[model samples]
Target chain A: MSVAGSDFAVRVEGLEKSFGHWPVLWDLDLTLDWGQLLVLFGANAVGKTTLLRILSTQARPDAGTLSVAGYDPVRTPNAVRRRIGVVGHQTCLYDDLTCRENLVYYGRLFGLTDIPRRVDEAISRVSLGHRADQRVRTLSNGMQKRASIARAILHRPPLLLLDEPEAGLDQESTVMLQGLLKEWAESGGAAIMTTHNVDLGLAWGETGKIGVLADGKVQVQEPGRYANVAEFRQVLSSSLVTRQRN
Target chain B: MVLVWKDILLEVRSRELVISVLVFGLLVAVVFNFALDVTPQRVTAIAPGILWVAFAFAATMAMSRAFVREREQGGLEGLLLSPVSRDAIFLGKALTNLLFMLLVEMVLLPVFAVLFGFSAMSFTLIGTIVLATLGFSLVGTLFSAIAAQTRSREIMLPVLFFPVILPVIIGAVEASTRAIGGETTVGLGRWLPLLAVFDALFLVICPWVFSFVVEE
Candidate 1:
């Protein structure tokens, strides 16, 4: 509601995005602030990924005022990019480069001076130090996902845009990722992650927001509510039927 | 500088583009030898065309490989998400493609000289090659980025690339033909100017086009 204020990390007002004539997001609005992790739940083709792309400044909205860290994504993309880290469905890792090389590459993008030490720290953070020298193509899908997380957090961006960061992760990696995110949020950083797994999505960040997107709108937005997964699931299923029928 | 270094480093480590382009260019020259059966007298006439055609094909191979690598691994989005300006990224990639093509040409030129029985070393010839390769790589890098986003990227790159680069190839071939004919002064007159103008035009245009393409 108060997206323009400096307290908020992401602010979207009247956002609309479409591919050609097919509209994906229609008159949607959302707000997120630092020290919170918002888990967005949506059905397939509900424009969750498109929304994330717009927010991350990789795609433009057809019409809307979308800002990340108080900078407009369309006009001030570079400024917005400097403040955010995105981990999408794609691992975004070079198949030929080893895990350490990939991390070091991203570190250099962020202008980190001591790349070797930072790369080692990130590799150990994701628990991938054992396979640091291994090519990404040779690593497991779960390991690749960990490497993506490592790359994203290397610069310690203020806002994190995660589109299904947990998709390929195993139980141990998932737990480690959650721990890292929790620590980040506790330290006043913000994140918005989209997921199909309602259980895992709802379980994230107790005091944060749970938004259900259906039919190109935020069908159910219960910010600071639905602390438990069972309650969130019940509301989500009913909201889906009601929103689809409407 | 970092973007260009990363690309060169990746290619060096992988050895994917250089090895394949070198072999491909050599094979094209070998094919030309058997197909044409040119005598020493006819070497200057046919060799320039053969050399440029071979370079064009090899350059296209490198162009496709460079652009597609980022998309195949989803690294393009990571690049777009970085704070670096799009112009820098475009220049870095163009430089890398140029470097790859030049490296292949460096090897192929000497081999072609041996096979065709012509002395290939000349300042004018090297100058023409540099100018032509710059223009070729700039357009190729821009179009390759455009093609990489499409469903049929491999098919799309050459379709978008070759027609646009005809002026460059023709200019290079003509200038190179004269240089090999031992007429350096005349070769630098019309065709070299053409190559320089084309290179300068793309040096301004490609980066702008690349920024627009990646922004969308």
Candidate 2:
């Protein structure tokens, strides 16, 4: 399907990833365009994080082609990595360093100049300016999550991948995070966030696409479209009942 | 280049690795002072071996902690996702570890001089320290990266590192011993070349091996 401004930020065709004998992502085909927010929904072990890792060039697909910003992730991972930022269950921040120090450290990793300014801007953007100098280990979970988000965006990568970014966040932090994500999308950055919160996903549905992944495949790709909320709830309930019976 | 500098800067701030290594090297030097007592004439003969053993043990201690900070805070994945070359990561980490090892040697040199009553400040001894520590850190950093990924990483680091780095330690200690003894024998010449060869071999191999260790 042709997306508006069809210049895709991330595109994968027949991407297959497996560990030993167990397949995690099987023949998965996905495309995400710039300026779009894509929320991927999947049950645990459905390959959501695996797909994100492969897209971010942190892991290689066993078969087929995957590209981020037109560079093949496996063959040209560094080039792909330059354009992608990832925040996963792993905060990927040094606990000994202050939040600002962590961002500055990552900024240098990206070979970014004007690191102080970039770090300052990211800290302000994440609304953690007051706590920038606090060690990451000392921060609360919500604060640490914000610091992680700041670090991920320090270089302003065009593509952002977040795996369960809202896992331990409070309601207020979740709202703030959602607002930041909306701003990032509005500013022409593409994001793919995985979450189990259907309500949060629905909040983003107006300007975002949704994919339901199950059993190592994208079972549905409904873009800016979801079945009626009540009907979806009913379907979900029946599926849970079926699972319980089995 | 940037990542390497970052690690160096971070090390400068914390100084944990360097301090631990320096203290450990001094402790080893003290222990060796009594364990390998020698006549004044033989003091120079045994100095290099003692220095290297101290440096290698201290370096391994520091290298194992290189990733501990990253692993504890989950920053390794962030590093792996960056555009930096894997070789740069390996070199940066190994160089920082080497720098800490050098710091340890710096402290040990004076202590050895005072304890053994023989100066180890000669240019040859200094050169040996530089070369030997490079070889030691190269192997230590690579094995430390591997150990960080496994269970019981603390215990596993030295267990895995000591066996694999036997050649480097032997080559380095032999070269240092020969240089200290003021013996320009052909065998001494062979040790220097052998130390250089091992350093070069590890420098080339560790970066490639590090990529596999960091891969998800």
Candidate 3:
């Protein structure tokens, strides 16, 4: 539960992983600072989620090193877990528990003091207070996603790992999420978010890094590399097509 | 404690595990009461075996149910993603299963007594039940974690659970039979302590094994 004295929020180098005969992430390298956000883009079956899993200490890599908040994931996974909050595709909320109950359970798991206050704060952060008492199974998909986000940020960790966090969100909810994330980034928390929406990813990463994952590697680009979204979109499409051809 | 609290809350809300296992245990006793040709002479011996079988199958059913909620709903992943240690998760789950099995046993023990025509309820029998249930719950919780990772988990749980817990079941049957027959010497001399030994051994080993296997 102790934070390592490192400037970077996440660091990975020469990382490799595969499922059976299909390689997902190979020789992938990434680094994010404490106040930065990285929006990862890839094809449908690419290794974006896989990489996030490895970074979050949920999965081990086949080779290379992973450091989250300056601690090695393989050796000190609990420390890494203590420092990061993840919003995965699964929602990770118990269907039978109310949104507040789910947050309370997770808050207890993280060993947070003053759980009721923390739970209320997280629900407010996600704007889920109106539906906080409803069971997760009874909520809309968008509402459930917000609840999941609430659970993720309940601990107020230094890092956030989000996989398709905006998948089922409506326009307003998505904007709210963006605003929350913007505030999170501004408050010196780091995040790595993956999405299929290229324009959205570009917009989100405009202040940090945008990464295109293709052919077992990531091509990371800084915001200043391109002047506009269309140019960046063309470059990304061509890179993906070329990688697919290879 | 928090994990167990959540499990208890869920069970309280759903009434799934205890109710299903209670009904299943009762059905087993009923079926055996009719299926077996138990004369007064054989009732002492035969009833013990039937009771243990009922308890074992019911405990196995409970074990399967325990993990299905977590696995089917991605709750296990959520647990892993949290800051809790694996040992806490294993102990919490095993304790909940033990509590649940004990609850089912309390209701079924008397019903079995009525169905099989024996005076029931004693400290010896209760102690024996606790020891036996502890052993199997410890082992079953570990195997349940393993089986939850497999495809045919419904079949896999019993297939993996029964053989590993045979000693506990046998000990339970022996101790229950002696306790019912009022053979304090035999019940205390061998079976109860043996069940305790198995429980202790599994209490140490299962959590260790669980820590190793719980990681995917």
- Which runs of model 3 end up more than 4 angstroms from their true locations? A1-4, A222-228, A235-246
In candidate 2, stretches whose alpha carbon ends up further than 4 angstroms from where it belongs are A1-6, A221-228, A234-246, B30-47, B183-186
Q: Tens digit of lDDT per residue, candidate 1, span B1-216?
A: 777777877887889889988999999998988899888989999999999999998988889888878887788888888888888899988998888899889999999989997788898899999999999899999999988889888899889889999999999989888888985466459988999999999999889878889986
Model 2 residue A106 CA deviation (Å) reads: 2.3
Instruction: Kindly report the docking quality category of candidate 3.
Output: medium
Query: DockQ of each model against the real complex?
Result: 0.73, 0.59, 0.67
Q: Model 1: residues >4 Å from true position, as ranges?
A: A1-5, A223-231, A235-246
Per-residue alpha-carbon lDDT of model 1 for A21-131, expressed as tens digits? 888898888888888888888767778889988888888888878778888989998888878888998888989889988888888887788889888888899999899
Query: Chain B TM per candidate, please?
Result: 0.96, 0.90, 0.96
Q: Mark the 10 consecutive residues where model 3 chain A has the least summed lDDT.
A: A237-246
Q: What is the lDDT of residue A84 in candidate 2?
A: 76
Q: How do the residues A36-107 of candidate 2 rate in per-residue lDDT, one tens digit apiece?
A: 888877766667888888888878789987767768888888887877778889788766678987887888
- How does model 2 fare in lDDT? 0.78
DockQ score for candidate 1: 0.73
Better model by DockQ: candidate 2 vs candidate 3: 3
Pairs of residues at least 3 apart in sequence or in different chains that clash in candidate 2? none
